[model samples]
Target: MDAVVKKIIMEVKKGDQQAFAELVDLYKDKVYQISYRMLGNVHEAQDVSQEAFLRAYTNLDSYDMNRKFSTWLFRIATNLSIDRIRKKKPDFHLDDPVGGTEDLNYYSQIAADEELPEDKVVQYEMQEWIQNEISELPPKYRSAIILKYLEDLSLKEIGEILNLPVATVKTRIHRGREALRKRLRHS
Candidate 1:
């Protein structure tokens, strides 16, 4: 953690609104990114991110000083996104019978970029395809991948965020990545 962030957290613990606001400004993008990746919709991600911050702020007294504030905030965001996912009930069992009907505008933009070489374009497509496959993974694996890769959190941090053992976090990340790799290779 940076000294500034540490200071802000300390101040926040003492009920400083300005310090809390600063902390939120520092972490909002990261929270939003995690939410966006998990929820797959900008609007829901925004709502979840906002709700996470609000919940964190309201429960600031419960925050531990020993941990990184970003980690704490991300945990809240992840839980909120998962709750939203449960509420929506996405079907993980079905394959796309109508090939390529889903939103490919984001994928298409990357593929259309002239700056990328042919090999790079292929890699991008594969990565995008893998991301789509990951969405079909069970919730636990999906959360593991989002935290490990998209949020760049360490296994210990991920374990802390998800309230799981470090070994469990490692297993989930490995299994999730392997599943994604298999799906991409076969596709």
Candidate 2:
């Protein structure tokens, strides 16, 4: 942890509410990004991110000072995301026609400045498709893949977040990649 972050965490532990807000400011985007990647819904991601911080605040006393704070917080968020995934049945699709319009897709309705070049449009569509496929993955593999690739965390860091051994993280990533490749090949 950075020294400044360490000091802020210490202050938070000492019951300084402003210190906790500072921590939220520092990590809210990251938490939301991870949640968005995992959940693939803007509203659900926001809700999950908020819930993660709330949970962290309530359980702050249980946090081990020796462990990386981000890792601990991420673990909480990841577990909550997994639980949400298991509870909800997916009723939405990215490619679904927007609000019952037969011709317009959800993506086509997204406002863009100027006109995107053909290559950029193709690349953007491909990225969106990949993200959709990722959201379909089992929670275990999805968490590993998102943490490793999207978040660019080291294997050990991912392992810590997911509460798994490094080798297990590696296996999950490998399997997740293989599944994605198979999906691409079929598509």
Candidate 3:
């Protein structure tokens, strides 16, 4: 974490509303992306993301500064999303399969590097297809895949965020990618 972020978190822990707002602004998109990937619905993801931040704010006293703040926030967001998923009677319909638009923008930079226009189009299509396939994965696998790839978090960081062992996190990422590859191949 940056010195400024550490200072802000310390101040927020001490009840500084301005510092809390700054932290919120810094992390809101990350929280939203994780929630959105897990929930797969824009409205629900937004609500869950907001709730995660509120929960984090209320539980600031319990936060351990030794760990990354982003990981802690993501853990809250992931748990809230899981809770919401569990509460739904029909899980698939509730999930809504919203492919990640944020990821498309992130990959657009890479797509631009393709020399030929046809290759660029193919790259874009492949990315979209992969995103759709990933969204269809079971929630556990989906979360692991998103955190490892889209968020660019290390396996250890993912383990901390998801409260899993490092080996388990690596397993999930591997199996999830394999499943996605299988789905894409058969499609």
Question: What is the C-alpha local distance difference test score of each model?
Answer: 0.81, 0.88, 0.82
lDDT of 2: 0.88
Candidate 2 per-residue C-alpha lDDT over 1-187 given as tens digits, one digit per residue, 9 for 90 to 100: 4677778888988878888998899889889988988998988999999999999999998988787889999999999998888887855875788886878987787787799999998998897888789887888899999998888899999999998999999999999999888888878
Q: List clashing residue pairs in candidate 1.
A: none
Between candidates 2 and 3, the lDDT winner: 2
TM-score, per-candidate, Cα-based: 0.75, 0.84, 0.77
**All predictions: root-mean-square deviation over Cα?**
5.3, 2.6, 7.9
For candidate 3, list the clashing residue pairs, or say none: none
Clash numbers, per candidate? 0, 0, 0
Top model number, lDDT:
2
For residues 42-105, write the lDDT of model 1, one tens digit per residue.
6788999999999999988798877787878889998998999999855432232435666434
Runs off by more than 4 Å, candidate 2: 94-120, 185-187
Give the number of the best model, judged by TM-score.
2
Off by over 4 Å in 3: 91-132
Poorest stretch of ten by lDDT in candidate 1:
90-99
Better of 1 and 2 by lDDT: 2
